[model samples]
Every structure is written in structure tokens, then in C-alpha cells.
Target chain A: MIVAVIALGLLAGASGLLLGFAAIRFKVEGDPMVEQIDAVLPQTQCGQCGYAGCRPYAEAIAAGEADINRCPPGGQNGIAALAELLGRDPKPLDPESGIEKPKMAAVIDEQSCIGCTLCIQACPVDAIVGAAKHMHTVIARECTGCELCLAPCPVDCIHMIPFAPSITTWKWTYPAVEVKAAA
Target chain B: MSALFPFHGGLKTVRHKTESNQTPIQAGILPPRLTVPLRQHIGAIAKPLVQPGDRVLKGQMIGQPDGYISAAIHAPTSGVVSAVDQQPVPHPSGLSDLCVTIESDGEDRWIDREPVDYHRLHPSELRQTIRNAGVVGLGGAGFPSAVKLNLAGRSEPLATLMLNGAECEPWITCDDRLMRERAAEIVAGLQIMAHLLGPAEVLIGIEDDKPEAIAAMTAACAGTSYEVRPVPTRYPSGSVKQLVKLLTGRETPVDGLPVDVGVQCFNVATAYTVYRAIHCGEPVISRVVTVTGQVHRPGNLEVLIGTPFAELIKQCGGYRDGVERLIMGGPMMGFALHSDEAPVTKAANCLLAAGPAELAAELPVLPCIRCGACMDVCPANLLPQQLYWHARAKEFDQARDCHLFSCIECGCCSHVCPSHIPLVQYYRYAKNEIWAQEKEKQRAEQARQRHQARMERLEREKQEREAKLRQKAPVRTEVVPHLDPLISVPSPTKGEGSGQVG
Candidate 1:
């Protein structure tokens, strides 16, 4: 009985040592939970979530310093997803962030652009490209419609426009009644 | 007759064929204005060739095929282009799209035409000619026929080429009339298909209800090796997969084409158009559209592609009293059109001017009782209740797991539901949402990649700036003796240096 007990004890001790070594050998620098939270974020970098960017907001959420309902662009669906991930009850979006709206992109009026580069500096995602004293243009697909660059634009050239639905983007609307009527 | 295979589920709904088919097919009167939407087929919308005030002859190309999967668009009659702008199209969305409006000159003038010997041309060239001719599936799906014909390029040897003539939808006799009146032309087209695909057998499946159509087609196919097989009259038997199953016992793999199973199918009307294109050197400028339901003179009309639906209704002696809705296509899978101002496109098969009695009264929808009635009538063998449940809950992934794409939107499930749930609509909603979600996900992924790339680019620039500063420090020290001490001072440590530099 004593020999079997000793063997079990040694096995446990060896496994513990191996685990400790592994932990030190492959230590990850950042909190993996924060990365996961950031992944769930809409990544708009809108800063309406009471944080500087999506990653910072995710870090705050991971640390329990911020609420999950802070993101307006992610809206209710985002909260639900985060809640499911964290095993928390889903909550309604906090109204201070803003209401959900269709995706919009910043369009710069080339004629009105004064080449101040203020809008370029304001973009967090580096979606704007220009040199000082040169006209700036937004890389439309890259722009997250965060509206961060709007306030900095002196010329008011940048306009947030909703995407127009084309034939490729068109979807069928739900039918009302449930009866077969010959057309 | 060959032994027929039974499909999973179908409805024996009232066949209202006689309401319109009692009279022969009529030639549609030319409307004053024709507003043709460039996107008639399923692929890329045709690019406009004519501007406002430009004169075009009948059958002249107005919209050229943009891509390999696109079909060409032609003017229905000799006309002067009035406008090329957004107009109401015959779509369920009721949204306006780019349309080419033309004012007909009433002359119906023809452009210079030359018939091409399809046999003399190369196979690729022939397919291109057909694509240029704007031939597409006339059986509602409107898939470009040229793409469908290029099955020979696949590794799988072609086995069966089935021609669908089963006008199973009620009150739509366009295909029926086409078969009865122009069976020989359809056979000629079928011969061309046979030569292109070189299948082992050519089978034509027709519903047993139309004996005259069957006899006419049978007579037309007597000399050739093609066989006209009449299947049982069941609703939705005309659907591609169902018709394929009824004719041949082969089951098409889920999310796979009929060509995957060594079989390809085409509608009888598509074949007739192919014949016209090859023999008469014509593009698809017109088609036989059935104008039935609550009209003084209900019959099939050979309508032009760009003719307005309002004009076609007028040709049918106008609307009767108490017309509740105007539907496009058959009742089983048709959509309610908001306006008669919409123009007829290539996909239009039937237009129903339905009255209140004909349409099901707006009844209050009850919750599903789980009666399994919808399950029994699903031709695709999908559990509609489960799809409806998941779809209603917006759990699209779960619906997808249940093979949601297999549901052909046949409306059989909706027809059999005691709950009066628009099950097909729910499925459609779910599908569209899933598609939209997928597109959003793709866009998000692209944005993430771009963000990462920008971050990398910034990091690289910062490193290059630091390296340039380190290299220039010694040079500056040598040039100025008094400032040598400040310039030659050793750089700060790596961590502090980057922070100080910024």
C-alpha cells in the first residue's frame, strides 16, 4: 500500500514539474481573453464605446472595467455574442453610445479638399492617405465609418454616405400572406 | 413509356389550365413605350450600348453581354431611345433599376440578319453565338443557356439530356402552347443540344394532363432517338431537380448541379429560342407570355421582352372587376407585383390578374401546431418546421446545418401548413440574411487585413526612421566641431530611444 501511494505521489509531482516548465517555456505576453473579446468587436475603432479603439475597449471589457453594451455599431447582436462568450446575461445596448445605423463610408469632395492633412491625422485605422499640402483621399473600403475624421476636416469635404444597394446586393423581402394565388 | 420514379412530396392542387388554354396563342400588340431592364438573366447585367435619342432597329443589340455568364439584350422593335435611366423593373423588391426606355416607331423594322450554320462553326464559337443571341432558361430560373451548354468541358461524360415540358403550374399554358404549336422548332433546338452535349439518351418529360402537347411532341420526336415521356401530373414536377428525378431515377447531390450526376436539363421554351437564334439569326427579343386570370379574353400572348405589363393586360381586354392583386409567374411560387408599369423581362412566364375570390383571404396566422403536414409535402424532403423554427429565431447556422439551400422555394410547405405560416418566405428571409451576413463577414475580414497591413507598414517606417537617424549621427558629428559632443553622444537604450524618437 505504501509503495503504490509513493508511486502515485511521484507521478503527480513529475506531471506538475512538466506543466510548470511548459508554462514558463511558452508564456504568452497578452491576455488571450482580451484577444477573443477584441475579435468579437465590430473593429470600427469608432471610440463611441468610451474607449480609444476596439482593442482598448476589448481590454477594458476583459478586465471587467467596462460594460459589454458600450458598442453601438455592434448593437444588440454584438452584446448577445459577447454575453454568450462570457457566460453573462445579455443586456440592452447603452443609449449613450448611439443608435445602430446602416454602414456608411466617408467620401471626400476632391474639389473642396484644402490639403491640410487634418483628416488624415484623425483617422485611427490609417484609412486616409495624403501628404502635407497635398489632397487627401479616404481608402473607402478600409474606412470603418467611425466618423472620427469628420470633426477634424476644416473644409467639410468628407461626407458619410450609405451604400446604395445594387442588383448583386439586392435581397427579397418577406411575403405577407400564405395563400397561393395565380398571377 | 419508361418506368417513372416518384419524388418525395407534391400537391394535387386545382389545375386552372383551361381558363387560358381554351383559346390559341395570340400575338401581343406593340406598346408605345418599352422599358427594358438590362439584367434579365441571372448573371451580370448587360452593358447599355445606346443613349437617349439614338435610333435602333428591331432585334438590334441594345445591351451587350458583359461577362461569360451574361446574355445579350436586343431592342424588341425599331425605336428611338428616349431614356437610359432607373425605372421600375418586374422584381419582387419593387425597387427601381437601370432600364433602357425606347419609343416604338410602329414599323417593326428588322436589322440586317445572317443565319449561321452552327455545325460549321467551332463548339466554342457556337456557344459564343448563342450567348450573343441572349438565350437563357425560359423555365423561370433564367440561367444563361450558353453556360449550361458548355458541360462538355467537364471531366464527367454526359449521360442524359432532359427537355422539360411539364407545365405543372396552374393557369400557365405558355410552354403548353409552345409545344403544341411549335413542336418541330423545339425538336430542331433539341437536336442542336444533343449534338453539343452528345448525351447517351435524350428524354423529354411532360405532364400527362396535356394530351395534345404530348402527342404533338411525340410526333415531332418520332424520327429522332429522343423519347417523349409523360410523367404524372403533380404540382412542381416542372422544377429542374424534380423533373430530373421523375424522368431518371438519379438523385442530384445536395448543393450540386445536375451535371454533377452526368445529366443536364433545359426547358422546352429555351430549346425553341435556340432554334430561332440558329435558323432565323435572331436574338431573344420576345417570348410567349401567358396573360390569364380575371380578364375578358384570357390567353397566351407572344410578348416582346421590353413590353410593359400594363400594355399586355390591355391586350387581354383589360382587368375584370375586383382585381385584388397582380402576380408574376405561377401562384405556387409567384410574387405579388405592386405596379402594372413594370416591364416584362425574359424570365416572365405568366402574369395573373387575380381577384379577391381567387386569392386566399387574408386570414390571421396561427402558431404552428407541429402537425407534420408541411413535412409530408416538402418535395425537397426538408423538414420545413425545423427550418421555420430556426429561421424565425434568426439562428441561420442551425438552418444551414439542416440543408436549407436544398429547399427550392416551391411553396408546397406553405400550402400544406395549417398554421398559415409563410414558411417559404421565412426560409427566403433566412437565406437572404445568411447571404448578407456572409458578405458582411467577408468585408470585415478584408478590413481587418487592411488594418493589419497598415499597422505593419507604420512599424516598418518607424524602424527605417530610427536606422536613418543612427546612420546620420556620426556624419553630423564630423561636420560640426562645437556640436560634436552633443551629436556624438551615444544613443539611448533600444526601449528609451524609440520612445524619445517619437
Candidate 2:
């Protein structure tokens, strides 16, 4: 009886020491899952996910504090990808978030005056470039169509325009009716 | 005779060649207007050289080839440039594309012509000449022939130079007629290609159904090393991979081309055009098009590029009664065009005016019963059921893993499907969606890279600004050091006193 008890006690101590050493030696500095989730995000930084940025929302989702379907810009495709990655059931996008739409970019009207630089400050990606009381232009390639700058612009010169399909971007639509007779 | 290697599954479709191949090739009437799409060949759209009101002569280069993979566009006949804007093109999308409309002057004048000595010219020069002449694969692929002749820049010796005379598509008889009528010119083009590539052997694979075409080609190939081999008639047997397999007993590797196996194939019509370009100094402005099905005078017409379909149909006695749909290419792999107003491009081989009896009737789509009919006819040997399931579910990655890209979109699976499912359409949808996703991923990556670059530039600028400020105000740092002792002495004295007490 004594030998059995001592053997059990020794085993427990050894396991406890090994586990403690492993905890100290192999501890990860940051949740890698959060980084993975952040990489998959559209990275608009629109704060529609109730977080300040895409990284923070990814962190929240990784920490199990936020749902994966909160991002509207990502749409159903994004939700499905996230679900696949996290090994969870896919869900529809939350209705509270905005609906998914075609990719768009912000275009600024140069004719409008009174550049107060409010929009420049509001832009999260620094896509807009201007000085005080001067004409400002949005870099169409850089603008993610976040709409955060739209409200801050006093002149309301900013407009989100959907990308026009060029010859290269056009894809063939599915045939409406299948031919049943063989030629 | 070379031993033939059979490919996977294929069907023996009915031959409708008797309708169109019964008569000799006839020249099409000149239309009042020609609306030529800039993107006739597969790659980049040709750049327009003429604006509205510019008078262009016949065979005058009006649209320059944009890049390496593009083909030059020419005015089909002497005409004034009416407009260079979006016009209806013969595509499955039913959308408009940029086209150059020419108003015919009826003169049909040709530009100054001079044949080139291809033997004396360097291979690159020959290729450039061919490119300038706007020669492309007339087998409906419309790939720039110069690009294919360059052998993808591989130095390995070419083994077989195969000429495709296998007009396996049921309704298309243009190639067959070309071989029968213009066999000598096609052989001359083949000799030129052989001179360029120096392949060990030259073989022309024509279907046995056209015994006359095979005999003509064989007689033309006499006194030369080129061999005319008759292949079994089968649907899609004229496809480059399948033809290569049939003639050489070699299988093209998945995700690889025929050239990788030291074989190169060209259509018989493409060879004829090459001969015309090199020997006659004429660019590709017209081709033999099979105008059959529901037309009163159903036969082959050597039609000019950019001639509207309506004008061609008028020459063929117009559409007969019960004409339901107009299709471009063969009935098996062709797409239903929206309007007869669409112009004929270089890629169009046949303009099928399908009637009720000709086209498949619109039937209610039935669910896939998993009867394995599609599997039995799949030329690529893919599991159509699995592909359909995954593609319908938008599981593209899984579909890709099943060698989705290898499928040639031959429509064999859809043709044999008992359930009436458009298997080819599903495969096309999945392929397109995957391409779209890949493009999106690329754009996202580029954006991320740009953002990182912008951040790095900003940080460097900030550091540079600080350094410049320090350079501009050297006196401030000297003054600060002198005043530092006065501010620091009391604090150090207090610290020293505390240390002594401790």
C-alpha cells in the first residue's frame, strides 16, 4: 500500500514539473489564430464589427468574445471561409451589420471648396491627401469605401462608386435554359 | 500507318456535313457595312489605328496587335471608317464590345502586296511577319499562331508537327472543304511550318468520314516527308490534345501542353491562311464559314471578317421556317447568339441557324439521379457527379483538387446526361468563380503590399524630418546641455543627501 501511494505521488510530481517547464519554455507570445483571422479579413478598418479595427475584431473572434458573422463587407463567402478555418458551422451575416454590396471606391469632387481636413483625419487608411484649406483627392486604389469619411466631410463631395466592369472583368453568365434535344 | 491511342470517353455524333459540304466553296457577297470587333483573337484587344471617316483600303491594317498573344485586325474591304465604338458582338454574354464599323466603298482595292522569302528571313522575322499578317488558329481557338510556333521558348527539338483536318464537329464542314479544295496551298503552309520548326515528322490527321479530303491531302503531300493519316471520326477528336493523342499515341500531361510532349498541332484552315499570308502577301480578311441549318442555300461560303450574320443569312436565302436559335460554332460546343446583327469574327467557323428539330427543346431541369451517364462520357475521365455536387455547393477548392482545370469544356458530359443537367455549364461556373476569387485574392495581396509600402515610406519621412530639424537647430542642443546642469544639480544633491542618511 505504501509503495503504491509513493509511486503515484512521484508520477504526479514528475508530470507537474514537466508541464510547468513546458508552460514556461513553449509559451506563445500572442494568439496565432487571431493573426490568421486578421489575414482573412477584408481589412477595411470600418469598425462595423463593433471593434476599432480588423485586428481587434479578429482578436475578439479568436478569444471567443465575438461572433464570426459580424463582418458585413466580408459577406457570405468570408463567413464560410472563417467557419471552415475555425472548424465551426457557417452562419449567415448578422443583419445588424450592413448588407454586402459590390466593391466600391470613394471618389472626391475637386470642384467643391472648403477642405477642412476633417475627412483626412477620419480616414483610417490615410487614403486621402490634402493640406488645410486646399483641394483634396482620394486615391481610388487605396480607398476601401469604408464610408467613415463621408459623414465627416462638410461639403459632402465624397461618393462611393461601384467598379465598372471592363472587358477583362466581364464573365459569362450561366445559360438560362438547357437544350434537351441532341443535334 | 501509325498506331492510334484511344482517349477516354467520346460519342459518335451524327454528321450533318451533307447539308453544307455538298457544294463547292462560294464567295460571300460584300455587305454594306462591316462591324469588326477589336478582340477577334484570344488575347488583348487590338489597338485601333483609324478614327471615324478615315478611308481604309482592303487588307489595310486598321487595328494593330496590342501584345504578343494578340492578332492584327484589318479592313475586310475598301471602306470608310464609320464608327469605332461599342457594337453587338457574337458572344454568349449578349453584351456589346468595341467594334470598328466600316462603310463599304465597293471598290475592294488591295494594299501594295509583296511576298516574303521565308527561308532567307530569320525565324523571328518570319514570326513577326506572320503576326503582322494577323494569322491565328482557324480551328476556333483563335490563338495567335506565331506564339504557338515559337515553342514556348523551349530549346528541345520538336518531334511531330501534326496538321488537324479532323472536322469532327457535326455541323462544321469548313475545314473539310478547305482540305478538299485548297489542299496544295495547305501543304505549302505545312512545308513552311516544317521549315520553321524542323520537326522530325509531319502528319496530317483527317477523319475517315471525309475520304475525298483525305485523298486530296495525301496527293498534295506526295514527294514530301509529310504523311496523311486518317483518324476515326469522333466528337472532339479534332481538339488539340485529343488529336495529338490520336496521331502520336502520346498523352499530354495534366496542366501541360502538347508542345511539352514534343508535338505541335495546327488546323488545316490555319495552314491555308499561313500560305496566303507568306506566299500571296495577303492578310487574313476572309475565311470559309459553314452556313448550314434552316437556310435554303445551305453550303460553305468564304465570308469576309466583320460581315454581319444577317447579311450572310440573306445570301443563304435567309432563315427558313421554324428557325428558333442562331448559334456560333458547332451545335455541340457552340453558344446561342442573341442577335443576327452580331458580326462574323475570325473565330467563327459555322453560323448554325438551328430550327425546332435541330436544337434541344427547353425541358424542365430534373435532379441528378446519379445514374453515372455523365461519368461514362467524360473525356477528361473526371467524376461528373462529384464535380457537380461540389460546384453546386460552391466548394471550389475541392473541385479544383479533382483536376477541374484539365476539363476541356467539351460538353460530352452534358450531352449524355440522362438527368438533363448542364454539367458543362456547372463546370464553367465553378471555373469562373475560382478565377474571380483568385483575382480578388491577388488584388487584396497587392493592396496589403501597397499599404505596407506606404507605412514604411511614412516612417522614413518622419525620421528624415526629425533629422533635418536637428540639423537646422544645432544651437538649441548646445544651449540645452549648458542649462542641463542647473536643472540637474538640486535633484542630484537631494539624492546624495538621502543616500548618506541611509
Candidate 3:
């Protein structure tokens, strides 16, 4: 009995030592899971998910404090990707967050812009460029269509326009296949 | 027949060549107005050189090549620029693009022509000249020929320079007629390409269906060290990768080009253009187009670029009775045109006005029974069924893993499928979706980086503002050490009360 106990004890102690060594040798620097989740989330920085930005939402997701469906800008595909990554069942996006919409470009009515710099300060991606008291303009390419600048505009000059697919941006749609009715 | 290496899974489709190749290529009449698209070749669109009101000479550079991979555009005839505006161009999608409309002035005036000696000029300079001449692959790809002539990233010793005279797509006889007529000029162009590449062997692969072309090309290559080998007639044998394999026995890497296998291939028509550019100092203002299908005269015509399709069709006696579709290319890989009003770009090799008899019967698409027929006919040797399934399910990543981009969209699988499934369409859709997703990911990465930079800048600005305020506020803070403790805890209520009292 004592020999068996001693052998078991040595085996357990050896494994423990190996694991302890591995913990230090392969120590991860930071929360890499957060980074992975952040990569899956579209970095719109819209703050529709009740978080400051996509990164914070990703952090909350990593901490299990936020649901994956909260990212409306990310859409159903993003939720599916997150679910696949986290090994969870995919769910529909939360309606309270906002419904998925077509890609939009924020356009500023330049004539109506008061030059107050409110929209510039409110822009998350700094796509709006202008000096203080100068007429501000939105860089259409850089604007994420986040609609973050709309609420901050005192003169209500900011407008979100749906981007129409041009020849370069247009893509071929799925081929129509005839579905047979089940007998 | 030589011992040629065969590629996998090709079709033995019906050849509609005899209908078009019997007659000699005729010169097309100049239309009243020519609308040339800025984006003829694949790359950045050429920048407009003249405004709407400016007069342009025939062969004058109207659109300058914008980037390294772009090709220049020239006026087909001397005329005033009528309008530089958006118009319908010949595309699979009936969308409009920026076009340079020129009103033809009866006199086909020429720009000053300076023919350069290719032997004396450097290869790079020659390539630049070819690019300036707007010469592109006339095998329906429309890629800038000079870009392909460049041997920049190639590391291996050049093995073979294969000229594709295959004209493998059924109903397209432009290359065949060019080979039969202008063999010597095409050979001259091949020599220039060989001088640039320095390949060990120069080969020409023509489909066996065109015997006259083979004899012509062979006779033209008599004194030169160029071989004209006739490959067995097969659909898509004209594709770059397949032709490379068939002629040189080198299978191009799946995600790579023909150059990766130490081979450079060009269409015979492209060679002819190269010869014209260097020997005659002519830019690519015209190309031989096969006006076949339901047209009254199903023959080849050397139509000028920017000529309206309707005019060219009218030159061929217009559309016949029961004209069903106006296709831009061969029936296999071509797309239906909504209107013949679209101008013919450099890529318009064949404007097939397909009748009801020429088109495949509209069969209803059915479910796949896992029949390996599609796999048996795919030229790229990919499993089309699985690709179709993944694409249908929107499982793009899985489709990509199945080597979706390797598919050349040759439509061989679709042609052979018993279920009548549009397999190539699914593949095209999947490829486009993947490209769109990649572009979105790149945009997102850019946004993230900009956001981070903006945050850092704001933080830095706040710190600088605080430092400036501190600097402006006094050295007296350090003078009284006892006051620091009291100042650290601000009594906001007392201060507000004192301000109210004041």
C-alpha cells in the first residue's frame, strides 16, 4: 500500500512541476481572446451596442458581460463568426441595438454647417476634418456610416446617404435555382 | 501531332468556326460618332487628355495611361470630342461608364507616326512604347500587353514563349483569320517578346480545327526558330494556364500565373498588335471582331475601337430573324448584352447576335445528384459540386478552401452538368463575395488604425493644453508647499456659495 501511494505521489508531483514550468514558459502577455473577438467585430465605433466602441464591446464579450448579438453594425454574419469562434449557438441580432442596414456614407450639408466643430469633435474615426469655427467636411471613404456625428450636429446638417453600388463596387448575385416541393 | 501534355477535364464542344472564317476580314465603316470607354483594359482607367470641345487626330492619344498596369487610349478617327460623359459601354452588366465621344470628321487623319527599331531600343523602352500604343491581349482578356511583357518578379530562367493561336472558344474565328492572314506580323511581334523574355524556345499552339491557319503560320515561321504546333481542338485550351500546360508541359501554380512555370503566353492577335505598334507606329485603334451568330454576314471585320456595336452589326447586314441575344464573346464564356448601342471596347472579340437556334435550350435547374460529370469536365480540375454547395449556403470560407479562385470560369462544368446547374455563376458569385469581404476587412482595419491615432492625438493635445496652462499659472505654487495640500482638495460647494454671495 505504501509503495503504491509513493508511486502515485511521485507521478502527481512530476506532472504538477511540468505544468508549473509550462505556465511560466508559455505565459500569454495579455487578453488575446479580446483581440480575436475585436478582429471579428466590424470596427465601426458606432456605440450602438451600449459600449464606447467595438474594442470595448469585444472586451465585454471576452469577459462574458456582453452578448455577441449586440453588434448591429457587424450584422448577422459577424454574430455567426463570433459564435463559431466562441463555440456558441448563433442568435439573431438584438433589435434594441439597431437593425442591420445597407452601407451608408455620411454627407455634411456644407452650406448649412454652422462651423461650430461639434460634428468634428463627435466623430469617432476623425473622418470629419476642420479647424475650430471652420466649415467641417466628412471624408466619405473614411466615414464608417456610424451616424455618430448626426446627434452632435446642432444645425442638423449631417445626413446619412445609402451608398449605391457602382460598376466597380457591384457584385454578381447568387444564381436562381429551382426548389422542388417535397412529396 | 507532337507529344503534347494534356490538361484535365475539357469539353469537345461544337465548333461554329466554319460559318465565320470562310470570308476574308473586311474593314468596318466609320460611324458618325464613336464613344470610347476610358476603362477598356483591366486596370486604372486612362485619364482624359482632351476636353469635350477639343479636336483630336486619328491615332492621337486621347486617354493617357494612368498607372503602371494601365493602357493608353487613342482616337479611332480624327474628330472633335463631342462629349466626355457617362454612356453605356459593352459590359456583362448593362451599366454605364465614362466615355469619350468623338464625332468622326469623314477624313481619317493620322497622328505623326514614328516607327521604332525594336532591335536598337531597350526592352523597357519597347514595352513603354507598346503600352503607349495601347496594345492589349486580344484573346478576349484585354490585359495590357506591356504589363505581361515585363519580367520583373520572375526568378527562374525563361523556358518557353508560347503564342496562343488556339481560338478554342467555339464561334470565335478572329484569331484564326488573323493567323491565316497576318502570320508574318504576328511572328515579328513574337520575336520582340522573345527578345524581352529570352526564352529557350518559341512555340505557337493552334487548335487543329484550323488547318489553313496552321499552314499559314508554319510558312511564315519557316526561316525563324519558331514552331507552330497544332494542339487537339478542345474548349478552353486557349486559356493561359491550360495552353501553358499543353505546349510546355508545365502546370501553372493554382494561385500563380503562367510566369510562375517559367512560361509567358500571349494571344496571336496581341502579337499582331505588337508588330503593328513597333513596325508601323500604329496604336490599337482597331481590332478584328467576329460578327457572327444570327447576322446576315457572319464574318470577321476589322472594326475600329469605340465603334458602336449597332453600326458594326449593320455593316454585317444587321440582325437576322429570331435574334434572341446579343452576346459579347463566345457562347461558352460570354455574357448577354442588353443593347447593341454599347460601344465596342478592345475586349469585344465577337459580338454574337445569337438566335434561338444558337442558344442552349432554357432548361430548369435541378438539384445535384452528386454525379461526377461536372468534375469530369472542369478544366481547372476542381470539384464543382462542392463549390456550388458552399456558395449556395453562403459558406464562402469553405468554398475558398476548395480553391474557388482557381476556377477560370470557363463554364465547362455548367456545359456538361445534367442538372443544368449554373456552376460557373456560383463560382463567380463566390469569388466576388470574397473580394468584397476582403475589401470590407481592409476598410475596417483602416478605420481602427485611424480611430486609434485620433485617440492618441486627442490625449496628447489634452496633456499639452494642461502643460501650457500649468506653465502659464505660476512658479508661486512651488514657493508655498503648505498651499499644495489645500489646493489639492477643492471645496466646490463652498466656492459656488462664495461666488453666489459675491
Candidate 4:
């Protein structure tokens, strides 16, 4: 009886030591869930999710503080991706945030731009370029179509123009879904 | 004759060759106006070199090649630029592209010609000259031929330099006429390519249907190492992959090129243009286009680039009665144009004005009854039904796994489908969707990087500001000692502050 107890004790201690060593050896630096959730985000950085940015919102979600549907820029597809990643039920986007819309690129009316740099300061991605009191323009290719610049423009010159399919960007549409009638 | 290798699932499609090939290729009439799209070839659109109202000479460089894969654009004839603005071009999307419109001067003047000796020049220099001359594949896709001539970076030595003379698409006889009329010139171009690529052997594959072209090419290739082999007349046997298989028994790896298998392919018409570029000091300003289908004179015309399709039709005695949709290519892979006002591009092989009799009747698409007809006719030997099912369900990954990219969009499956299902359209949709998703992912990654960079910048600025404040705090502390006496005097006034608070 004594011999069996000592063997069991030694095995338990050795297993505990191994687990402790493994914990230190494979220590994760940060919350990987936050990074994963952030990766699934569209990264528009419009901050419709009530956080400062996509990362902050992702952190909140990882911490079970913020809901996944607060991002309207990500739209329904983004929400579905987030739900799949987080192992949560997919839900409709929160309407209070904003309505989902087509992809848009902000166009600065160059003639009317006041050159105040307010819109430049408001842009999160630094897609806008201009000096103080100069004509500011938005880089259409770099612009994430975030409307954050529109509100900050004192002159109301920034226009959110929806992108139209050009020859280069045009894509073939899916064929019509067939509905068969009963024979 | 070399040993012929047959490919799987090719239809014995109707040969509409005689209508256009009977007559000799005639020089196309110059229209009053020309509309040249900047993006005639694949890759980046050529940058416009001339502004509006600039007078350009024939063979003058009007559009400079923008990037490595792009081709230069030259003026077909001396003319004054009307506008460099958005205009309609012959694309399946029916969208407007930036085009340079010119009002023809009617002089048909030529610019100063500087024909280079291809034999004396290095291969790279020769390729540069060809690229500057705007030589591209005249068969369907206008891929820059100079880009294809490059053999650098390939580990294997080029074995066969195959020239595609198989005008396999029905109703298109441009290649046939070019081979028949300009066989020596085509042979000369092949020699130049062979010199550059240093291939072990040169093989020219002509569809056996065109006896005249075969005989002409054969006679021209006499006393030379070039061999002209006639491939069996099969629909899509002219396709680069199928032709490669038929002639060389080599299978181009999926999502790879012919060059990957030690073979290089070029269209015969492209070779003729290459010869012209070197021999005649001319650029690719014109191509032989077949204007058939419900036209009075259904023949081949050497149409200038930017000539309106309407002008070609008018030159051919206008459209016949009961003319149907105007297609930009052959009946199989061509798309209906929204307007004939769209100018002829280098890729315009034929302008098929298919009538009701020529077109398949508008039948309602029925559900697939598990018919294997599409699979049987697929040239790539892929399971068309499985691809269709996955594509229809938007399961793009599954479609990709079924080698969707290998599909050449030859429309063989669509032609044989019993249910009249547009199978090619589904593959195109799936391919396009995949491309769009890839672009979206790239954009997302870019946005994420920018956002992260901005955050880091803001944090660094905050740290710098805090450090500066810390540096200035010592001065403020030193000055605070002088204000100690004033602070002691304010201690008596604290009673007044407390009474006010109460």
C-alpha cells in the first residue's frame, strides 16, 4: 500500500512539473483571439463600433464587452465571418450603427476645398494629402471608403461617391438561379 | 507529317470559312473618324502621348507603352486628335474607356521609317524594337507578343517554336487569308522568333480545313527547317493549350503557360506583324478583320485599328435585312456589342453580325438532367457538371478545386449542353468572383497596415510630447520656488475661498 501511494505521488509531481514547464515554454504573448477577430474585420477604421478603431473594437469583442454586429462598414458578410471566427451565432448588423451601403470612395471637390486640413486630420488611413490652405485631394485607390472625413469637412466639400464598375474593375455577374417547376 | 496527338472533347463545329476566305483580303477604307482605346492589349493601359487638337502622323507613337507587359499604340493614319476622353470600346461589359478620337486627314501619310536589321541586333534589343512597334497576338487575346518572345528565366531550353495558323473559330478567316497571302512574310517572322528563342525545331500548326493556307505556308517554308503540319480541323484546336497538345503531345500545367513545358506559341498573324515591324518599318496599325454574317460582301478587310465597326459594315455594303446582334468575335466565344459605333481593336478578328437564322433560338434554360454532354465536350477534360453545380451554389473553392482556371472559356460545353445552360458564363462568373475577392483581401490588408501605421505614429507622437513636457518640467519647478512667497500670501485668502465654497 505504501509503495503504491509513493509511486502515485511521484507521478503526480512529475506531471505537474511538466505542465508548469510547458506553460512557461509555450507562453502566448498577447490575446490571440483579439488579433484573429481584428484580422476578420474589414479594417475600414471608421469606428462605427463605438470604439476608437477596429483593434479597440476587436479587443472589446474578445473581452466579451462589445457585440460583433456593431460594425456596419464590415456589413453582413463581415458579421458572418466574425461570428464564424468567434464561434457565435450570426446576427443582423446593428441598425443604430449605420446602414450597409455599396463601396464608396471619398472625392474632395477640389474647387471648394477650404484647405483647412480638417478632413485630412479626420482621415484615419492618411489617404488625404494636402498642405494647410491648399487644395486637398483623396487618393481613391488608398481610401477605404470610410465616411469619417465627410463630417469633419468644414466646407462640406467632401463627397462620398459610390464606385461604378469601369472596364478594368468590371466583373461578370452570376447566372440567374434556376427554379424548377414540378413535373 | 509529325505524329498527331488528339485532345479530348472537341466538337466538329460548322466551318463558316468560305464566306470570308473566298475573296482576297482588301484594304479597308479609311473612315471619317477613328476611336482608339488606350487599353487595346492586356496589362496597364498605354499612356496618351498626344493631347486634343494635336496633329499626329501615320505610324507616330500616340500612346506610349505604360509598363512591362503593355504595348505601344501608333497612329494608323495621319489625323488630328479630336478628343482624348471616355468613349465606347468593344468590351463585353459595354463600359466606356479612355479613347483618343481622331479626325482623319485623308492623306494616309507615312512617318519617317527606320527599319532595323533584326539579324545585327541582340535578342533583347530586337524584343524592345518589337515592343515599341506594338506587336501583339492577333488571335483573340491581344497579349503583347514581345513579352511572349522572352525566353529569359526559363530553365529548360525552348524545344519547339509553334506558330498558330489554326483559324479554328467559325466565321473568322483573318488568319487563313494572312497565311495564304503573306506566307513568306509569316515565315520570315518565324525565322526571327526562332533566332531569338533558339528553339530546337519550329512547327507551324494549320487546321487542315484551309488547303490554300496549308499549301501556301508549305511552299513558303521550303528549303527551311520550319515544318508546316496540318492539324485535323477541330473546333478549339486553335486554342493555345489544345494546339500545344495536338502538335507536341505536351500538356500545359494547370494555371501555367506553354513556355513552362519548353514550347512557345505565337499566332501566325502576330508573326506577320513582327515581320512587318522589322522588314517594312511599320507598327501594328492594321489587322485583317473578317466582316461576315448577314452582310452583302462577307469578306476579309484589312481594317485599321480604331476604324468604327459601322464603317467596316458600310464598306461591306451595309447590314442585310433581319440582321441580329453584332458580335465582336467568333460565334463561340464572342460577346454581343451594345453598339457598332465601338471601334475595331487589335483583338477584333471578326465582326459577326449573326442573324436569327445564324443564332441559336432563344430557349428557356432548363435544369440539368444529369446530362454528361458538357463534360463530353469540355476541351480541358474537366467535369463541367460539377463545376457548374459548385459555381451555381457560389461554392467557389469547390469550383477552383475542379480546376476552373484551366477552362479556356471555349464554349464547347455550352454548344453541346442539352439543357441550353450557359455553362461558360458560370465559370466566368466564378473566376471573376475569385478575382474580386482577392482584390478585396489585398485592399483589406493594405487598409490594416495603414491603420496600424497611423496608430503607431500617433502613439510615438504622444510619447515625444510627454518627453518634451518632462524636459520642460524642471524649468517650471525652478520657477516655482520664486512663487513660494506669493503662495504663502494666498494662504490667508484660503478662508475667503472656503466661505465662497460654503
By TM-score, the better pick of 1 and 4 is: 4
- Residue A84 CA displacement from its true place in model 1, Å: 1.6
Q: Any runs in candidate 4 off by more than 4 Å, and if so which?
A: A1-18, A177-179, B476-502
DockQ value for model 1:
0.34
User: Candidate 2 residues A18-134, lDDT tens each?
Assistant: 999999999999999998998788878778889976778999999999999998888998998899899999998998977888888888888984778888767767788887888
Worst 10 residues of 1 chain B by lDDT: B493-502
Q: Please, what are the lDDT tens digits per residue for candidate 1 over residues B364-481?
A: 6787888999999999999999999998888989999999999999999988887788899899999998998887767666666665655665676666667667766666656875
Clashing residue pairs, candidate 2?
A181-B360
Residue by residue across B14-115, what tens digits does model 3's lDDT show?
998999999999999989899999999888889999898999999999999998888999999999999998898887778888889999998999999988
Per-candidate Cα lDDT values, in order, are 0.88, 0.86, 0.89, 0.90
lDDT per residue as tens, model 4, B288-338: 999999999999999889999999999999999998799989999999999
Output DockQ, candidate 4: 0.43
Instruction: Give the docking tier of candidate 4.
Output: acceptable
Strongest candidate by TM-score: 3
What's the DockQ of model 3? 0.46
Q: Model 3, B445: alpha-carbon shift in Å?
A: 0.9
- Top model by lDDT, which number? 4
Q: Per-candidate DockQ versus the true complex? A: 0.34, 0.25, 0.46, 0.43
* DockQ, 0 to 1 scale, candidate 2: 0.25
